[model samples]
Target: MDHTAADDISHQANAWFALFHGGAPTPEQRAAWSAWMAADVRHAQAYAELENLWAASALLLQPSPAAAPVAPARLSRRRFVGLGLAASAAAVTAGAGTLWLNGVDSPFADLRTAVGERRIAYLPDGSTVEMAGHTAMNLDFSATRRAVELLHGQAFFRVRPSAAGEFSINTQAGRLHTREGEFCVSCENDAGLVAVSQGRVQVLTAGQQTELEEGLSLSFSARATGDIQRAELAQMLAWRNGRLVFFNEPLLTVVDALQRWRKGRIFIMDKQLAARRVSLILNLDHPDQMLDVLSRALAVRTTRYTDLVTLIYPA
Candidate 1:
């Protein structure tokens, strides 16, 4: 295809999109539009591509005040990013994902959430587990045992009574052994951040064992407790109510929280932008608005490819 001709088609596609966004057209205009779309195969393809782009930018288009927000339209496109071993090692991926197009189904996953979705699962032992977006967990039970494996992402566990004995949890990072308590664990970078909401849980990483009491949080990295801190347990688990609470955290960390509920992958290409400090409260249900606010506050802009991927770069 000629480069100039392809550009012309794209330009025409954008024009048609503007007309559609402007509102319903007259009969004559609709007929002309139909004729233009049917004029050539390339014309239809070009229009479809532009429609996908518009879908990806759904946040930018707001309807009347009383109308509900529009959902993102799914469309396929060519994958752009190619990360080799070296690049993958250097690029630290960050971002929240949500609004699952397709929920997960696995024999091992007794409880799971699709991308951009969160769910609560009630275990047989009267315990409850709240799963974050893109999270999966498997429950293990026996005459003398109860355990849960955090296969991926994060979850908040409310264990059965201590009279029933200890409940063990396994993640990519380490094991959290607890009883009669509520707590949350998040896995990232081959590590786990355990925040205790009530009662104490013994954390066993490698050969070390320590008790994590209420109001205390610890980060275990690569089978070891590296950094520990105290926090407001209630604030940490605010996502149960569909909100993200952050305080003096790096922009990269914020991105991780946002990825929990937003659909598609969001890439932050600038290291400096990722490292900047941030403090804010974000509503998980309105992820598009969240991204718009972040981009403006961080002096950045997003380049989206349909609804498949979103890339963030300095403006």
Candidate 2:
């Protein structure tokens, strides 16, 4: 293996993935990445390889690895992850590279689903949580209380009767209180929407409270809570079964939901175009064709820059 040459390109590919995954990137950065990929066929291949690497890691979301099968030394779960990423680094020992990743573990043992991934985690008390893609949350269970915080993204909670005192999802907007219920909460950009699929839950926002039974949803933001709306969330769960259902949903909202099950970013350069409405069913198995369906229907053109970024604008 020619170490020196491929190392620079692979590291650049990973850096581009990190930049695109972070908060919105400026036009210059996007253009630079585009040009970088266009410079050499190898650059494009390196990026494509990275995207496939992420898509192939669905197994990691299965359950926390008891222990890495390869390395002889003991390794914590987080360090193991950094060690995997280190495999793509230039010329360095994985052990030395992961020293920093070890000290950076979340205080409360945060669980997350990467882009294009979903996770099912069974809690200590028999309760289960289903996390949507690009989601992150933390669990803090004690004898007196059981609570999980949705730092970002969406999660479905299946509360167990004998779990503890109370099972609730805490957010900056407010608290979603439930007991022995099946509910979903999606929190993003300082707001959230809660829906009940079974049993009951209460949405406590600000000083007011709203009780929700099966087949109801409440949308709340950091500032105020909206009226209880009828949300067929069970349909949205189609991702679990390799399908996504959309009915008269805003184009931006649809894109946001679908983006979770895919790698990279979808930039709606035209804000007005983002407001267009879409109604369709997308197959999760072939995530790429999702953009195809919308592009043809809305007469909007989708220009995909490899697998790392997609651009949607009026055709």
Candidate 3:
């Protein structure tokens, strides 16, 4: 099959998997799903891959007997499926390989934050890093160079002025170089974002280079670069102040941000609802109210299957 056909099948498989995984399906829904599964051999294959991936992830993330007692929660199925899709995309080339390791738990990450947790790190060179919840990054510093590779999630960097060399941040999408500035970098949905709060920084991606001054922001991916646009510095950096600000942003984006600050998973099962635009500011201090707030704001209903799993749909 061609790439587009493969992607369509994958998406359909994921949607069906999510419907069944969220909770017990209605008889009609189950019948529909069964028909879909029986319609194509490739559908069964894709879904089987999802099941295997989920089983492996379950084993990998399972807490040991010695682990402290905590409220019951499961890893996000949505995230696992996303990982599978990404790996599949990378494996499109013949002879390519894929590794299904979680970035936040990877051994190579020098620093990481847990769900609903934030941390500040002071580097040897006097630079400061403020990591958001669920963020992970690796540090490579030497006498000649200072570098950080953001494996996933988000972090704000304040580079200490240095004549030695420019501090660099590496994300899957691109690289950012800066000196004597404060900026934030976020990696989400296969894209990287850089928003400058102070001083100037340079972004390089897809064989193109762009310079961003204070109050400017840009987003890039492996294959494309975005235009520099003026940014709302306060809103963009609100997480540092224990807030999340969204202005006419998609529900999918908001849900992704909320996932970082809370335990467990939040899934928008309805594609139309996920694409709905939202504008709101939320306090990160009270993550427990997230679902209720979203339900109220968007006129949706939230069903909690387990302490860890919450699914959103039209009211």
Clashes (N, CA, C under 3 Å) per candidate? 12, 0, 0
Once superposed on the true structure, which residue ranges of model 2 sit more than 4 Å away at CA?
A: 1-109
* Tens-digit lDDT track of model 2 for 1-315: 487677667657756765674347799999999999999999999778656644433332233356442322455667655644543452321111112212222334478876666789998778999987767788888877788888777778899876477788888788888778998888876678888878989888777898999867889976798998655553545566565656557787777776667665566667677777766566666665567666655788766554544567689
- Top candidate (TM-score): 1
What is the overall TM-score of model 3 with all chains considered together? 0.67
Best prediction by lDDT: 3
Candidates 1 and 3 compared by TM-score, better number: 1
Clashing pairs in 3: none
In candidate 2, list every pair of residues with a backbone clash. Answer: none
Q: Would you list the rank order by lDDT, best first?
A: 3, 1, 2
What local distance difference test score does each model get? 0.70, 0.69, 0.74
- Residue 208 of candidate 1: its Cα lDDT? 80
Model 3: residues >4 Å from true position, as ranges?
A: 1-104
Structural RMSD, model 3? 18.1
Model 3 lDDT vs. the true structure? Answer: 0.74
| Candidate 1, run of 10 with poorest lDDT | 78-87
